[model samples]
Target: MTLNTLKATEAATLLLDWYDRHHRDLPWRVSPPMAARGALADPYHVWLSEVMLQQTTVQAVKAYFDKFLTLWPTVENLAAAETEDVMRAWAGLGYYARARNLKKCAEAVAREHGGRFPETEEGLKALPGVGDYTAAAIAAIAFNRKSAVLDGNVERVISRLHAIETPLPAAKPEMRRLVSELTPSNRPGDFAQAMMDLGAKICTPKRPACALCPFGGSCRALTIADPETFPRKAGRKEKPLRLGAAFVAIDSSDAVYLRKRAASGLLGGMTEVPGTGWTARRDGDTSIDAQPFAAAWEACGTITHVFTHFELHLSVYRAKVAQAVACAEGWWEPIASLKRQALPTVMKKAIAQAIPHAFKPV
Candidate 1:
């Protein structure tokens, strides 16, 4: 075997052994609190939390996860909720796509599996938004089946163990393969958990706790005395800048009019102010050609937010409405209750700026 293969093999053994002893007690890892009234390690809960945890920190996701469980309680509950409710529930949590997928996946399981989560990796993967890693995780953790799981955590652990210098995105396939090789046939759940714990606690992205790591002496990166540089990253490209206009309309009752986004793309299916697609702020391009609601409208200030590949500049406008209209599909949500409604961070910032001049902080 190659030296890379040799190191990965040894690292997996030591890391799993360390994990079997030092793993933290997270609520999601334990058996149900009580048989009569408790949540179990079911595929539904596993899938839900896994989906929420993507690109989100554990601390950030904790409150949102608890709130969701309180509101929906089960996959069927979430599946049955209106799309806007799901979007709002997912407010503040970026990556709106996951929230949409959560509902779609739940509904699919409900309709096709009679409200039961799929027990096999293949079955789980067939559901909407269930990727390879997610499918393997649910299949192993919930169903106790042996399926190879490779996520960012696993990739970090495997990359360091083997000291692969390839940058990410491109390096992922090989990382997956290396981890799959180490995924032992027995106790696959424990193995998966072990790798995750090792990544989060010891083989970290920054200055790894090599002294505490079980494979400290054997880790190729550690042996080379440069753990931080092992997982080399490619250079980043500059994000494009985009600009748009947003109309925040308020009625006599202090209710703000929010329109539901189209069913796909960024912030899809979420609530937002009436707006136009992002474009350059050049004079000719930004025609404010006011609609009927312009009677109460006034140009406010602007807010800026950046996405993965684009920057958005929103020119804010305020409008007043005496009577509500069924302007497309949306809610006439109270401005005071906007916090409860899920607005994207950008739109929420715009609303906070648009708080009525009378009530605006003195």
Candidate 2:
């Protein structure tokens, strides 16, 4: 097995050596020096961080990771955690289903597996939300199993090193197989981390620092003088813009009307002000007529938030009413306590549009 023309063993060695010197010091990962001294990250830490890191940046996940560990210091603690509390902490993370599934996976580990994570890839995959990539990652990083761990960073590194022209999705299988072959039996976990670090630091999507790359001597993309052009991706289709309206009702004492969202769709199990259903069409309702309850609803402004599959435009409205109102399935959250609620980013944006000082620094 070889990476381009170099023997796979040699390629792994070069990458590992570079990693020992320059690997990133991330919150969920053990440093190369620690790994060299035979330390590995806890399985719970690895799993939680992996789930949080899905489609999120390291910078974004750090605070959330720290918050989670502080709240539920162990897998059993997270399993027994109130789902509402979990959702509240996961408000800004965007992908709500992952939060739900994270709770489920934790419960499964706590109850079914005796609070110990599965050590094998297949065993981990059997857990909820643990797909092939996540399972492989947990097995390698947490259990030190010889499993192939290929995330986005490693994908770029492989696509460039082999100059594979297959566009992604179609190219992923080939990339996985190549990574499996290059994974060393001993220190396999460190080897996997090294590949990821090299890709993140040296073989970046933009102007990569080829001078610092360990694989520069053998990278087919670099030899061809256009490394960035590799890992070619198919064009993205334009997301349909869905239009709706949101109502922000405030009481005499400055509390905002908010309610819990249904627990099974976009922004599931989060909090939001009343809003019209998002329908995909240019003529979908975006007027004050779509308000949850009638008041002297005054139109203020519109806020647009982009989701993975669609973009949303919400026409925001606010009205102040007497504090002696009664409502079922909702609450009047004081403006000071709104930040602690499980309001998604879109809802926060809508609230901010209605009340400019809604999320001001305390």
Candidate 3:
């Protein structure tokens, strides 16, 4: 069947039926049956999970989600919580900006919005870090509004269902329009969740299970072209290479020197070891001479970490200074307590490279 030939109501009903039988029981989500039993999705949980899920995988986010809920339990609690504490809890999740904005949003909701989330998409979008997709998701799931929720999974499903030819980003508007058209007024939340679940479970990117998909007959990609081949993307540009140096100053008691990053740039407000500024040019001083303090600095290999736009290669150096020699602007954290710090993954890699046993279990 063609795109126009497939009735929106029919497609929604089929997918909802499938979803009723098989929805993933996630910690943050109130499944269809749970909704039927008078349970509603929590806006705070939905917002937190959506923020964490950006550029991150579901498996990677589960523990963090649980941790946040346990720590705050409500938007008001999160607003009252310390910013530094939130950053520490959000450590290793990458995207430090999200953590910063998460704190700001919680404060806004508690202080400005009277401790309640807004019911519509526009109101939700006004919150910090809540973008178009996030606003739609929260509105539909939490408020039962007829907003089109299109995340990566839904994008794949939409692009293939209509065989949208335009590359993503550019193709997003058309895809959204189609989704809005297909989104039913009754149980719009369930319809949106059904699409996401269908994409994740059946219409996967690689070798989609066409035999199991409810929209198998109506899908344009399945009929005219390969289903997996739809949702075409533009070619990716090569990530630029950035070079830097990391200095690990350790004392006799197995403690490493650590400092906080700047409040507003890459890895903002996170813990890091002494290091040179990352630069794309070799003229930059990524050498031992750029060490934070004078000591017997020895080269200890290098660490390569990939960021969104650049790949960083940091030359590692370690120095065993006296226990009396304390860093002027930073604190000495014991190696065993490193896990509790707000260190990003790159900083951890640098520490591990220097000590080798810094992150090992006792």
lDDT of each: 0.75, 0.88, 0.89
By lDDT, the best candidate is 3
Flag regions of model 3 displaced more than 4 Å: 279-284, 324-326
lDDT tens digits by residue: candidate 1, 157-193: 7777778888898998898777677777656776787
Separately for all candidates shown, the number of backbone clashes (residues 3 or more apart, or on different chains) is 0, 0, 0
Better of 1 and 3 by lDDT: 3
Q: Native-vs-model 1 lDDT?
A: 0.75
TM-score between candidate 3 and the true structure:
0.96
What's the CA error at residue 360 for candidate 3, in Å? 2.4
* lDDT tens digits, residue span 168-189, model 3: 8899999899999999988888
Q: How do these models rank on lDDT, best leading?
A: 3, 2, 1
